[model samples]
Target: MSNSNSTPLMARVTLGRALRRLRDEVNHLTLADVAATLSCDISLISRIELGKRNCSQQHFTKLMDLYGVEESERDRLAELHAATREQRPPWWARYSEVITAEYERFLGFEAAASEVFEYQVGILPGLLQTERYARAVIGAGFASLGPDQIDALVEVREIRQRQRLWDSDQPLSCCYVLTEAALHFQVGGPQAHQEQLQFLLELQERQNVELKVIPYAKGEEGAQIAAFRIFRFADDDVPDVAFGESVAGSLTMDDPRDLRRLHRLFSNLSAAALDPDKSRDLITRIKNKED
Candidate 1:
């Protein structure tokens, strides 16, 4: 499988999806069939379909021949070929500066997405974090991190949050589900936890936002999983993507089967969480304890 979290992977998926749509219009030519025709491994076909591998002009020519794509459609596929260069960012690109290469790709995808659905079991999602809260969280996780590194990480988090509401014609919509443990994590001690919890409440009031909490009693349901986000696009042009962190790195899933499983997981998790008002009340009760 390709490194799914890479921006190039996303571009590849966009290209593959366009090709797959063209293939579907022609007939039910399965990927396996295409691989057999190309005399390649099934894994290679899967990677091509998922945009995990870059396709060359020769590959494009082969696809046009196999799909019986028209001259105009051929032009469009060529456009995808053109995008190979377009997808590479400039030498001065800063969108990925402070983060790992894989995470930088994840950030690029999140920034470009139209909507994001996330669940955080251990701590607050970076998008909803305040500078102090973010720094504290980062420091806690990396005791060896210098103040300068923490500042840069916080800067990235802040930039990502600002982009969420970036006055674009297409602003990102966010739906966040957080666990009670997140509210009490105390990254910057009790005061910072209170402020962060308050920020969550305020975000819940936004038109493009919805926030919920899985109370402490929810136990395993609340704390069993690591945080993850699902990015959904308005363009039928692109497929929905799910990004989850691993010991190796973050993983992005574009395959319909994989996405379906993740979607189901999120749905069940959300269903088990408290509703917004109740979640807010749960947070308020926690805050009152600190008073």
Candidate 2:
């Protein structure tokens, strides 16, 4: 099977899905059959269909010929395949040495997401985190990291902050549900914590950002235990992508069943969360308490 360590959004959206559907419709066309037609290993075919790897133009044209895809459809797919390789690398690619395969892939899609939904338990979401807060979080988790490594992580986080939530003309449409525990957790002492809260208050004023707080009184659910993000693209054909991180590590999901479950849980959590006005009021109260 193919692993999705760093698949791009374009390949995931068009090439992989179209090829998979076409392969499915034909009778008696197994991975073995496709591999034979492409003159490669069966694993290669699997990876191409999973969007974990891209086939050469020759291989792609050959497969289309094998599947007997319509000329018009093949042309569109060929164009998309070309674009996939041509798309510029996301900013995180520069920091690939320090970043995990999972996060690298997350950034690839984050760069393309039109709408983002997030839920957090005990730490601020990366897009909303302040410089000091991000530094503290990274430092605490990677205690052995040197100053240079720490600085790079902070820089990447700041870039993500600007691109995803603060860009004046093209910011992502964001909905965030922060648990009361996360609101109260002090990452970098009272002053730093207060500043982080103040930052969230300011970000909430943006028209594109929706900030919500799920209070302790509202209780918790299983979904609240892990911080996860659901990314929605503008085009309907591009399926929603879910990336989640927890003690066990991170994983990505595009399966409809997983997306539906996460979507439902997000809906319920949103319903339980405090509204924007009230959430800001809560943050203000916490900031004042720190003073």
Candidate 3:
């Protein structure tokens, strides 16, 4: 992603994980026992724990009752359950006039996620883009958009950055791993590129941000995968979500296998990337270079 605001990176609550967390707190109630008490199928409970399906209201209420959850807590859980299963289009769906369905779905999860980790292989990821760089990137990619449409898109990106940094009630924590080549492939003019690097330097000062760079090294050269992001939620109710995109479309998954692969790749990327301080130094050098 070249813009500073690509996909939203917040966790969408998962009823299954939340329910499983609660059930496990019931002092060793067996799975069969819960099914028997709730008069539901045991396999259904397993699916719920895996976040494979949504639970019905009747069953959800019964589960809450079985867990002896507080009335107030039950009210909140009920609301969240309803939201997760909302039949209405997600907030981003309105942007379907401008964006694809895959991108729209990504926004839903990104908006609600608490923590986001990204490994960028091409240009800088959207979260770190400056306005000028963002404009340059947008202008190049979608030459067809009218000035008004482009302006609207840029405005959305700015709002996205603000929300992640501080505008939202809960600020998003971001860890970004960028390829060293991204710095060399400048988007905006020299001055704007320099300014973007300076902005990155400033952003690195924030406690919630971690920026690392993967240099062109021998053994790790082929290890870098396509850019992907992992979003984690504040509560266990939502399973961690992972997303990646290609020329065709986007791929998002919360399956255990998918998550495991992302986690391992992220871990490896962290190891391969330069530490924050070194990454900053590299950026400074690139910025200072005569363009």
- The whole-model lDDT of each prediction reads 0.74, 0.81, 0.75
Name the regions of candidate 2 deviating beyond 4 angstroms.
1-9, 25-30, 221-223
| Model 1 regions more than 4 Å off | 1-9, 20-46, 87-92, 95-97, 143-145, 220-223
Give the runs in model 3 whose Cα sits over 4 Å from its true position. Answer: 1-13, 16-77, 84-96, 218-223
Best by lDDT: 2
The 10 consecutive residues of candidate 2 with the worst lDDT sum are: 1-10
In the range 103-211, model 3's lDDT, one tens digit per residue, is: 6666666776788999888778787899898988888878999887677667667767887786766678899988887888777888888888899999999888999
Pairs that collide in candidate 2 are none
Q: How far is candidate 1 from the true structure (C-alpha RMSD, Å)?
A: 4.3
User: Which rank order by TM-score, best down to worst?
Assistant: 2, 1, 3
Q: Answer with 1 or 3, whichever has the higher TM-score.
A: 1
- State the local distance difference test value for candidate 3: 0.75
TM-score of each: 0.82, 0.91, 0.74
lDDT of 2 by residue, 1-291 (tens): 011212355455557777877887664488898888777999988878777687788888888888888889888777767766765776687887789877777787787778899988889889888999999999998899999999999999999888667663567889998888898888988889889988898888889989999887886542366888899876555678898887777788988899999999999999998899998998898888877
Worst 10 residues of 1 by lDDT: 1-10
Question: Alpha carbon lDDT of residue 112, candidate 2?
Answer: 72
Q: Score candidate 2 by lDDT.
A: 0.81
C-alpha RMSD by candidate, in order = 4.3, 3.8, 6.2
Q: Lowest-lDDT window of 10 residues in candidate 3?
A: 2-11
